[model samples]
Target chain A: MGTTGGPGGRRVGRPRVSQRPDSGLTPRAELLTAAADLFTTRGYAATTTRTIAERAGMRQASMYHYVSGKEELLAELLESTVTPSLTYARGLLADDVTPAEGRLWELCRTDVELLCGGPHNLGGLYLLPEVRAERFAGFHAVRAELKDTYRQLLAATDAGGALAKSELDLRTDLLFGLIEGVILVHRSDPERPVSAFAEATADAALRIAGI
Target chain B: MGTTGGPGGRRVGRPRVSQRPDSGLTPRAELLTAAADLFTTRGYAATTTRTIAERAGMRQASMYHYVSGKEELLAELLESTVTPSLTYARGLLADDVTPAEGRLWELCRTDVELLCGGPHNLGGLYLLPEVRAERFAGFHAVRAELKDTYRQLLAATDAGGALAKSELDLRTDLLFGLIEGVILVHRSDPERPVSAFAEATADAALRIAGI
Candidate 1:
């Protein structure tokens, strides 16, 4: 058994630890990568520990040396994808005290560039069902916090007359809604660039604000 | 071996023609309802014919009496949801040659109502990985046709001076972007009424069009 880290940048449940000759890379890193691919393609429930172990060319028992179970594997996959992007997003916001519109544009760009870069498994996790129901509890809090950041931008725009006077709640939701919606479309059809969606949404937001 | 009608309202697959004496429901109906529940909750891949059969209280072998396989089940789910609504939408367009703005609103309302209502299992299908990859081959065609209808409406509005003069292609995509964005949001958050989304999107579309 190999002990592995869960997705939250921490150890989750207890798993048996097996000392393997370091393949020069951390066992945890290898396990996380294999888990991410299998989970992304076959989904969390459909992809068992055995399947992941086989994919990684390890015995079933040895697979647990790194991670406890499927849930932790899922947690690790989600956490790796979400936590870094979120940390970067916070930094982007902190570095910018520009007008709300500019800040919002930067936020949209950050998400698109982060999520849509390469043919990675991260995008699938964003749309996965079981992950959303179970492993996504932590991610949702991060998402809500990000939404608040967007709301602040919208509020600032309204105050500065960058947008037409509109209810803050509606504007916030609308902006959030468009961004999420665009991400979904881009995920579904990778050919569709996120930059296009960002521009269209930003234009709409600016129009609403009368900016 | 009991037979079952295949999914997608196909004329035949493995037809279990006999109605159960006490249940008064066809095995096909039972399977579909159970499949929908399971598909939405556990997700498509996590769901199995055996599980669906057991949920329907039929033998695993007997489950094949109703549908060919899971893929067909997905097709059936889509048929029940998208086909009728699209048909109704065509009818609405045929019946009323309203201005573009009005007709677009009708399209939005109709789309929401249809999605939220009958064959709601189709929504879950959209979230399925396999379905997302293959099943949506026809989706763009549906979207293109529906978009054409809206473009016609926009042309009428422009002629009437109710909307600003704009190129049809960009205007159509923008309109689509808003509506598509709203529908995606509604699907994610079932608590929000489709009507509310329709209103918000319609307002946004009108504003963007300068109607």
Candidate 2:
């Protein structure tokens, strides 16, 4: 088995440090999936780049093609949980045809599903102190923008319009709290389907909107 | 530099290692306060018993008289957050006079206030993987009991009674998730009065009830 192109058996770009069977499809994606698994399972600061690379089935040095260090991996993983939601939220904000209530409902449901959908509870990683560092400010800022989107969507609702200006921030905070808090519940009761959780939360979020 | 007693100060225990000047008062409580501060701020697994004792202004040896180890401190701190609520919930369950909805609102309001009332975000410690260990099962059990009370209260409500049997758990989960999720919001914006925060959440919880 030489480095050029070995026999068929889950070999990607460069040879792995010592392959231990993983869901070997795309090498880069596989590395990220492995990083997500380790960061959530083992404490973030405790996880080493060497260990992550080995788990991803690549030699530590060879893994640098995709990531500079654990920071890069951690940052990317954090972003994955929020970026899609933000994009969809922005689109929902811009879509003038849909009712604000409907848009907010979809946003809540999808956000819950996405937060719970990962094989690992990646949202749990938000608790790590390292996640508060400047390196993760990008993730934080994106999250803030997403929350603002929630605020705007809530404000646009007929019910939201009925409330005082000061009421919007408090309402958004409560609604967002419920949506994000689903991670902790799912972490303990993972048997529930993501779709079901999302629907139920969206339904509940409406109560907050009008309450 | 004497060991017996200090002249005119809040020192109520034996000598200290290094006087760092915490809110000098009851030694055991001061130790716990310091532990809560470090566990939430620096993180649980990272903080050491030695550091906790040092912050509380006691020798490591003296600190042992109150707590055997960090696990003991952690268990106590975790329990502190839930036991009072559990006690009140139990009383509310038996009261027979109060409406289920009102009782539920009071519980949510008080729980939020207590969670944010602490100098540190102790609920944030719930994120530590160590918290899920068997050693903290007592805390988990009490928390489960509290949630069960929420379920019972919800089921008793006219709104909750209208819901199908299957819907109760999902509703209880959403309401609870919002209640617990307030800790994360309060952590970032600790300036808001806990009383105001509680009132706002309890108000929002009613929406979930009817929604």
Q: Write the per-residue lDDT of candidate 1 for residues B144-197, one digit (tens) a residue.
A: 576666666566675324444444544555565555555445555667556665
Candidate 1 recovers a fraction of native contacts equal to: 0.33
lDDT of 1 by residue, A96-156 (tens): 5566667666676666555555455364555455755645687667766776776666666
DockQ per candidate: 0.29, 0.54
Whole-model Cα lDDT of every candidate shown, in order: 0.60, 0.82
What is the TM-score of each candidate's chain B when compared with the real chain B? 0.68, 0.87
DockQ of 1: 0.29
lDDT of 2 at A146: 93
Model 2 CA deviation exceeding 4 Å by range: A1-17, A20-22, A25-28, A59-65, B1-26
**Can you list the residue pairs that collide in candidate 2?**
none
Cα lDDT, model 2, residue A207 = 89
